[model samples]
Target: MTIRVVVADDQALVRTGFRMIIDARDDLEVVGEAADGEQAIRLVRRTSPDVVLMDVRMPVVDGIEATRRIVADGAAARVLVLTTWDIDEHVLGALRAGASGFLLKDIRPTELVDAIRGTARGELPLAPSVTRRMLDRLLRTAPRMSAPDGLESLSQRETEVLTLVGQALSNAEIARELALSEATVKNHVSAVLRKLGLRDRVQAVVAAYDCGLVRPRRP
Candidate 1:
């Protein structure tokens, strides 16, 4: 399926550059552009892009808040935060606000295209270290009253699959580790997602961390 994307950046150059890269891909297309955070939200609402490439710094609203609002509005769009480094201040906020992943601006064009496509399919671009860091940040902050409701519905085996996902393990790796068939792993992943009402693997990871199924810090 074609993945519709919204590029939200303050600099005209950045937006233009991304548009060129995305539109060049047969599987990806840039459906709209936003020069500021407010415009980003508006455009996303109007266009219903499958994924949003959000700049951390914007004129009126920051990408973090824009992501927060978009998520709160119950949009199915995935937000990929753009930052200078993988671990920026807004990176944590955006993830906490339900972003799929954060990518540095200096990433190669090929990787950016791949990451956008990944995000469109509910995948994350985060490394294990970034996932650990974001989970640590979440642990340090005030605990929330809830996790994404429905984790309670997961079976013991499904919960095991989700914990591995939170740790950034791939399907085959999880299958090998769990001594289960690859097909079984895929089914478990689907069940976990359905039980948690999450859109993708990234959200599943986030839910796993918040629910204390995975430790935020490595031992």
Candidate 2:
């Protein structure tokens, strides 16, 4: 199936560049383009794309607010936040606001395409550099004060899955670590999300950190 996408960035050049890369893929299509968050939201409502490439620093409404509003409005499109700064707090805000993934602006074209596809598939495609920094900040700022509500609802296996997810491991990686099939790991991940009342894997990651199931690596 062709994955429809909307590229939302303030720079016309960036939008055009992304559009070119995306449209070159047979399975990907650029259905709309927006120069700001509000326009992005409007395009999403109209085109119902599978994924949205959102720039965090866009003017008027900002990517975080746009993501929040889109999720609040129950739009079907999953948001994939893009930013130049890997450690920007706005990236975390965007994820918390319901973005499905985050990527640095300098990501390779192949990786960006894969991320878009993965986000559409409900996979969290956070960049490794960004993930470490984001989680470190989360650890320092949010700390593991207490378990998030609904955490206890997860079974032992589900908890394990959540822990791996928080560590930014993909389903295949989680499966390998737990000696389970990828399909089984996928089911466990779904269960973890459902039990924890998370919108997606990004929220699951946050929940994992919040519940102390995952911790920052010691230097």
TM-score per prediction, in order, is 0.86, 0.89
Candidate 2, TM-score vs. the true structure?
A: 0.89
Q: Write the per-residue lDDT of candidate 1 for residues 147-205, one digit (tens) a residue.
A: 77787788899989999988777788899999999999999999998888776777777
Across 141-192, the per-residue lDDT of candidate 2 in tens digits comes to: 5435556678878888888888888888877888889999999998898888
Candidate with best lDDT: 2
Model 1: residues with Cα > 4 Å off, grouped in runs:
126-146, 217-219
Off by over 4 Å in 2: 126-134, 137-148
Per-prediction RMSD in angstroms?
Answer: 2.6, 2.4
